[model samples]
Target: MVGNMSKKFNSFKEFYPYYLSEHQNLNCRRLHFAGSCLVITLIFVAILKSSYMLLWLLPVIGYGFAWVGHFFFEKNRPATFTYPLYSLIGDWVMFKDIIQGKLDI
Candidate 1:
């Protein structure tokens, strides 16, 4: 649920808790992590192969997987719709947390 629908966060620290709440579903978190890994791989491939065209798929891959997670798994609206910047930051932070074992799979 988007409980913070009317709440405005002035800092990422404040937004992160809400972000985590939205991603409580295991499948949603996994999809997000997988999407992030793919995004990273795609970036490296684009740079190493000099294929700037591949860079164009970044948003499609990143947001596509995330949207699927939110819609199908989380059964909630993505924070991206309302808080684009913080939500993007939250994605990376969540990825890092997952990798570091701060969050359960």
Candidate 2:
């Protein structure tokens, strides 16, 4: 595994660039975006159908696809392994950026 596992960021803002840097691969970004979208859709479906069980799939869906991207495409350790909170925030922010064309997948 890569080292520097203890590097700390004071805030999500400080972590995002590093997060983006790790996701430079186009396919990795696309997988992260797709995973986030599926997570959002799963949440809505769970709410609308009153099937709370579906909510359990959120982490699997989100992290599964993302891990595949990171491991196979990006070939880097996921930031989530080091910075869970900021990494989560980075996921949504990156998703929004892709949608808004601020970032290209």
Candidate 3:
């Protein structure tokens, strides 16, 4: 229906499940984690390299890879579309969980 979305999140508990569902496939989740990690590293490198231009393409390099996995591998809508900020947060949280061995992908 593409109805207008509310810009408010009532709770993380509600949002986390949706986040997990959107990234259920192992490959999709792994690709997202890789993209995020690369993006963070790129940010630090950009700062060190004095190449601020790379900052402009961070979202594209990160989300482009992740979205490719979501659409091609997972065949699912990205949580980012429905929950931009929360989904961004979820990406970090999920990445942390993966690093801590609490998540597979």
Off by over 4 Å in 1: none
lDDT of prediction 2:
0.90
Q: Whole-model Cα lDDT per candidate?
A: 0.94, 0.90, 0.83
Ranked by TM-score, the better of candidates 2 and 3 is 2
Top lDDT hit: 1
RMSD of each: 1.0, 1.3, 3.1
Candidate 2 residue 53 Cα shift, in angstroms, is: 0.7
- Model 3 alpha-carbon drift over 4 Å, by segment: 1-9
User: Model 3's lDDT to the true fold?
Assistant: 0.83
Which digits, one per residue and each the tens of the lDDT, describe model 2 over residues 10-98? 98888788888888899999999999989999999999999999998999999999999999998888988888888899999999999
lDDT of 3 by residue, 41-100 (tens): 999999999999999989997899889888888887787888888888898889898999
Clashing pairs in 2: none
Distance from true location, Cα of 90 in model 2, Å: 0.4
Give the range where candidate 2 is weakest over 10 consecutive residues by summed lDDT.
1-10
Error of 1 at 90 (Å): 0.2
Model 3: lowest-lDDT 10 consecutive positions: 1-10
Each prediction's TM-score against the native? 0.96, 0.94, 0.87
Model 3 residue pairs with clashes: none
Off by over 4 Å in 2: 1-4
For 1-77, candidate 1 gives per-residue lDDT tens digits of: 45566789999999999999999999999999999999999999999999999999999999999999999989999
